[model samples]
Target: MAGTYHKDESNTVNRYKHQATYDVDTIHAIVNSTPVLHVSFVPDTSVPVPVVLPMIGQIGHYPSDSESHCYLHGYVSSRLMNLAASPPGIPLCVAATKVDGFVLTLTPNTHNYNYRSAILHGHGTVVSSDEEKLWAMQLVTNSVVPERYENSRVPPDNAEMQSTQILKMRIESASGKVREGVPEDERKDMKRDDVLDSVWTGVIPVYEKLGEPVGGPYNRVKEVPEHVRRFVDGENARRWTYAVEASRKPAPVKRVKKQNQVE
Candidate 1:
């Protein structure tokens, strides 16, 4: 939920103490907005580095009975040696994309998606705490399957934690950009028969769906656990309903009214 940091008039980077906005709502929206995040980092040394890495981690609450908050954890490189080149305080950029609608225009270049996306640039430090690392692993599980921790077995010891490396990024600058509506060329292109017919055009919506849960291998009881049943009926249902409602809501109107007009 880090707020967008504006450059000072003098053009120097501000410290973390400056008045900044990191609203919970903004952070939640950014976390759920996209399922995939593209993470990029620079090696501390002058050697050339790869520009992109695909990160698949859940950003959600811890498993224990507590208020849910956002936590991000995932393995960067499988090879332990790759971690050496990464600096302690260097900034890493994480970006997410949520395609809400499509923009079909008269020209091919104008085609785009109506999306809500977030780009966060910040420095991440390698986690060395035993307790924090265990909590991070639990957070990852809960992110993927809400309330899965309660139904599953707890992580026993530090050996598992030691195997995984966690990084906590202090989010410095974040920006959210969104676009939604019918195509910009809807009015003009509708009038042109050739332009309209040449392209098969319309909006194709995307959504996440939860299928029926399978029983765990170790479960003695044959029936699905109550937690699994409740999750399917509760959170998953609500999310889909909310997404549909958001899609149906009319885009904000920006018409201007004449001054002193009462009509």
Candidate 2:
């Protein structure tokens, strides 16, 4: 959807309004591209402390659904599964981040990382419908490698389905922030020839590199599958391209919120 997510107290950008985005496509893109999403929720109301889990998740629309939803693959913790199964669901936060480059500045205070980050706040409930569950399962499986569900033994067995679980999160609010550029230094340092001569200012481009695939002991496939080969090669190129591009852009200006910076 081209429509943007509504900004409210819950989703407002406090400081970096210039880099913050409420666009639906931008937020979804950041989430989908990240390898792992950190899902956090309060496990016990009495304790009021949140539990964070590194989970595999993807966002997409189901055939029968009116809007897109976030689906999480949760085969790890039974406590999280139980909490997500209740009616009306539990409050959850999902965060994804990709560090593109490291911005090294003249001073430590201005040092930062070029990155893309997204946060989604939603109510997550167990996917009870078998048909929807199946679709979500496939949605998550292919997220790792394109067309993976079709390329492998799929239509999960009954036992596999029974053991696995999928949590559907109806997003209430979402937002994203992006930082890309070389380095930013205060005028005080920029004018100092000594600091300029001694300090190095540049960006170290960072990207995830996919290594050669190794087959498991039981795997009898003669060569790497087409889907696997394509995804690995394509992702490596895309990742490097983005990191380098982001590294070359003009440095971003700081817009710190008043009364927030400590002495």
Candidate 3:
């Protein structure tokens, strides 16, 4: 809320200037709350093609570091690890989006989504420090489900530690856009007698709802663990409440597009 990311050409929002935010806290919140993040990078492959990988990541503030960086992990990406370990690290882009509701308008072109999105640009380096890596591993684990790391197997053993690699992407800039509220249409459409009578307009709430826990085959515990149950219940309630509330907010002011701008 207090510290904001400096806006620059790379992170500036030209189109919905009103919804764009460079707030550090807001960007972190959007990323942390989203279940998955898409990280894109270029690899030195024979063909040299861009790769977009879905990863589990969270922004963390370590006591040793002056600024926060996103810790990344996924099904072992050895190539990315190698790139990160190289001098100066590898350039990376991380994006996350959470859909709150679907805005239905009189016409299809006016339909839109209520959402929060963030884009981060940075260079990622492999976290070589064992202490920091361990801490980051725990941080990512808990991000998925609170207290999951501590509840699971204690400090990772030699094999686990050796096999896992975590990346610290020192964020250079971040930009976020948030869209909420109900349906909005042009004045012409709003005043149309025939069109207005024929069409339905409103917002349909959307959210990621966690279902009842199903125990694994090897799970001998009779009842669901307190942590697991708590996370399921808590996430469902929070996500649903936000979605419904967003659907009820006042619609965003419809702006007239410039003659040169395309819809």
Candidate 4:
């Protein structure tokens, strides 16, 4: 057991405790699986509302370390990026969610969705060093479409780099919650023969299916790029399989053995 991440008061999961996981690997996977992350921050205390924005980002770690940091890129003059770049940086919360299936039950009260979600609390600090900024920018670009950075162009030109700013967020705490398997009905509902006969109860598997690529009119490439083609096919297949299995079977609950007191 690599030590578990500390659960701070704010991140402690209060509902469905069994669905909560503080494991770093589980939390990272959930964050990476979602395409876009929603970032929320209060620009100023005087302002009544917080601002939320959809952003593209990725999680990565240093070669010698297990801890991870999130990298995000935006226009140099954007409001959010400017605020994050200010001294001490701005406090932000990042959230990502992926819905696997819609659990339909005989009773309205028992209905719920099978999904995976993660929340990360961090301070958004700008990446200043040129080398690190380039690396982080490349990471974010590739995240949108794998291998896209290399396939399209080499290192970005000076103007492009100058216009873009990258933020390296230091994660303070994180939590992940996942729900899977078929609908769970109450004993009373299951025992009622009439209810069972009249209502259809099961999971309606849901997945984000990628469509075929349609290139632009000016596109010179004769065929769709191999990397792009593979990504679409691969993602669709993975989601389809996960949805099918989760619809029928229960997720396996893992039990960990306790370490010996004297070990």
Candidates 3 and 4 compared by TM-score, better number: 3
- Per-model root-mean-square deviation over C-alphas: 7.8, 2.3, 2.3, 5.0
**Candidate 3, residues 125-190: lDDT per residue as tens digits?**
988888998999999999999999988878899898888888889999999999999888988898
lDDT of each: 0.58, 0.90, 0.90, 0.81
On TM-score, who's better, 1 or 3? 3
Q: Candidate 2 — what's its lDDT?
A: 0.90
Task: List residue ranges in candidate 1 displaced over 4 A.
Answer: 1-24, 57-71, 78-88, 103-107, 186-201, 216-219, 246-263
The regions of model 4 sitting more than 4 angstroms off are 1-3, 62-66, 75-79, 251-263
Candidate 2 at residue 39, lDDT?
Answer: 93
In angstroms, the error of model 4 at 28 is 1.0
- lDDT, residue 155, model 4: 84
Question: Total backbone clashes of model 1?
Answer: 0
Clash totals in order: 0, 0, 0, 0
lDDT of 2 by residue, 100-207 (tens): 999999998989899999999999998888888899888888999999999888788999888878888999999999999979888889999999999999999999
- Higher TM-score: candidate 2 or 4? 2
Record all residue pairs in model 2 with backbone atoms less than 3 Å apart, i.e. clashing: none
Between candidates 1 and 4, which one is better according to lDDT? 4
Model 4 / residue 55 / CA error / Å: 0.4
